[model samples]
Target: MQGRSIPAPNDWAAQFWSPIVGAEAQATRETVAMYDMTALKRLEVTGPGAAAFLERLCTGKVAKSVGSVTYTLLLDHDGGIRSDITVARLARDRFQVGANGNLDLDWFSRHLPADGTVQVRDITPGTCCIGLWGPLARKVLQPLTDEDFSNEGLKYFRAKRAYIGSVPVTAMRLSYVGELGWELYTTADQGLKLWDTLWQAAKPLGGVIAGRGAFNSLRLEKGYRSFGTDMTYEHDPYEAGVGFAVKLDKDDFIGKAALQRRKSEVRRKLTCLTIDDPHSVVMGKEPVYDGGRAVGYVTSAAYGYTIGKGIAYAWLPAELAVPGTPVRIGYFDQRIEAVVAEEPLFDPTMSRLRG
Candidate 1:
């Protein structure tokens, strides 16, 4: 499990573990791929006030039944996007929060109620995660355990406690790469065994151990936004292209009033651009020009191996965000031609993910 490694955003893991990222990216599309997602911050929220506390802070409904997962956002008072997180209700009084990083942990810790009815604990150090995804993900996993991994048995956005071989795991039916899969979690002591078990089972099925490089390319193709790279506190859910996660009809939550006021006033947006030339690519933070004037900058960019084009997400004026609007990205000495394209560039119908 070694190759050329690069520094990741988090200090605990490498940006990539393999040299050939394209092959890994292809594996995720054509077959199964295992990703080391241990760098993802994991948190445990428990106590009598767990559901109420989370519902107050999250924009989406968090007070759901056990084994349910909700993709939600943590917003600031000004309706700015703080973090996009997933809240999994493990029990009546317990939740597993899949969050960004230390900043999210700090945000949750700072907002704890004075009555001490809720407890937030960092669980990253004690837990590890493996993201097994692709068309054959269920095939690779089903034989290892008795638990039903079928679409009907463990549906999307759901969580179930199960065992993979001898390793106890909590499997969440979700995918960052827009593929059919589950994020399998286990204790640190069982991490090695879990990885080995999956790898051995998937070997005959043509599964590859992928890295962050392929993961980034896959997610961008799916139009998934990374918290810090594609958005920040300055952007709102609408402008960030994640307004679907915001439920204004729900009861009072953080930034509810501000979001209501800002909903109809969006002036800018995180727009998707596709390079005209399939070979041309930008490395992000490059200036984007509308006509002759620079109007925005690229936030995240990757070569869409699956789509046979270059993809970049950039911040642009609302008028320039329309599909088919032409733009140019300044990459060092060259200005590459691109156009505002409808996302996600791949799997717009999400049939692959649902299967």
Candidate 2:
């Protein structure tokens, strides 16, 4: 794909917390809710060779069926993750990739072909996004669109174009918080209409506005990883416990060869742990101990409201990264007792998100 010059980012990210008002706990537990996702960069890949071009650039299969979304990674030459991204196949000739920053755009600039058969355009400034989450999300959104939003009609990881209250939008079924949710993406000009409409519909159904804090707690409860913090260029997929997302058998792509070799030889593996002391919450980067020695460290952590424990992720020796494996996490003056817990503490089966 031929890539365009990067567009300057909008200020929406700075406004995410300013206008929000309500108890964030309500957004996590029930109702349909909204989260300002404008901070994430969104880009469009289009033209004849869009799919094939992206297939070569990412670890996951990007030439997917239309209207589907794939969670994939852009890796360095040595199988280290450069960026984790989401690609939605909007149409036969169109794809949208979203991530936290400009790294993906830099990749495009370096690799996209000069020919016009494929093209990449940064759409971050012109687009805005808000997510509808929790149990009542579907119900609250159904009235605003003509499309079928029932479980059978709009399945997880699927995307489709529609309109909400006169604003054209693309809605995708996804869950970062382990609940039924749709992230509604709209043009910047229609952003206000989109948010107001969704908010108006959500009020009667018990929905509330959520900030980044709610997302932190919700995502941790679900064992979701934050790209730079939990999985990065220093950590391979196998060591990060996300090897399942890699398809090594596919036609050769970046990181394929190195990833294959590291698969079974992984010395350290990522896993979840829970602290017994609720008051001593670990906000991450704490040292983990085994037999009075520092064995590993935490990558991400938060208080999981649903599980009612301080949830954490750390890379430990493969043998110690097991359920009920006792350990200790050290802060300044305290060493909190902990146990390796099964991940996705809220819904291990993933039924809630699927529903």
Candidate 3:
């Protein structure tokens, strides 16, 4: 994503003004910030067997009710993650699928029954998403829609259709950051309009527009897993530390048997690691050492701006995944003092997002 514009249409002004107000910390503490997420493409799936087809392809129980959004993973036949996705049931036979790229349409198509029980349409060119994330997200957004935006009215992980200043939107009560936020989706033509509407609301609420730099830091602080980085097809759900997303008791999905067997034999796990040295920087692929032996490596790393520490996630042997387990992170030639930390170091109780 280097040198690529974030598709913040007509956002040159905000990009220029970020230096003045958006230091990221402001968004985390008091107000809301908008992140351009058009790079993460969306797909539309429809037909008679759309729900059944998805159920067979994912690792979680996909809901068939309209306006419900479910977080599920598409796993390979061997139980390895192919992609992580959020499926929003738009109609009885129609669904909107969100993924990291447009190419996932091919994967969705390839899994379709030869008899044409499902249809996949790539909607990236015509649609886009903007993540309005932070503590004051509701405060900034509630006035634009007649629909309720309160925590009680709109529960987390739910989706609702509403008009935000005349722009059609599908708002999902979800955020990568552990804060009260929403990911709003709209047509590409109206993307800038929606951004401007929210931007105007943010001005008085002390919120500022944040860029991808702040976006990454916010998510890392929340311990949100990055699919390709934190996990790959090489690791199973149990090993990836996202077993909560897998439901084996549901009807048999593609990777059910493999995941069920491996649950009992899980050898490695993904755990958060914090470097005792606050200034130490550990990009991905840094080897972790337990005593003198090499064990696992960091897949995702960033500074926890809120916690005032450097955090990283590594795949370690299950025995070494415990919190407070002493270890050393090899950052370049230097060994930084580190230890295993329980997931979601920033908001373990998740009061902020739920509030």
Instruction: For model 1, give the 10-residue run with minimal summed lDDT.
Output: 4-13
lDDT of 3 by residue, 228-296 (tens): 899988999888878888988889888788787788888899889886554466778989999878898
Ranking of all candidate structures by their lDDT, best first = 1, 2, 3
Per-residue lDDT of candidate 2, residues 268-351 (tens digit): 878899976656657678899997999999988766656666678987898999899999998777788989988778888888
**Candidate 1: TM-score?**
0.94
Error of 2 at 76 (Å): 1.1
> Largest TM-score belongs to which candidate?
1
Q: Of 1 and 2, which scores higher on TM-score?
A: 1
Candidate 2 ranges with C-alpha deviation above 4 Å: 1-23
For every candidate, C-alpha RMSD to the true structure in Å = 4.8, 8.4, 6.1
Question: Candidate 2: RMSD over Cα atoms?
Answer: 8.4
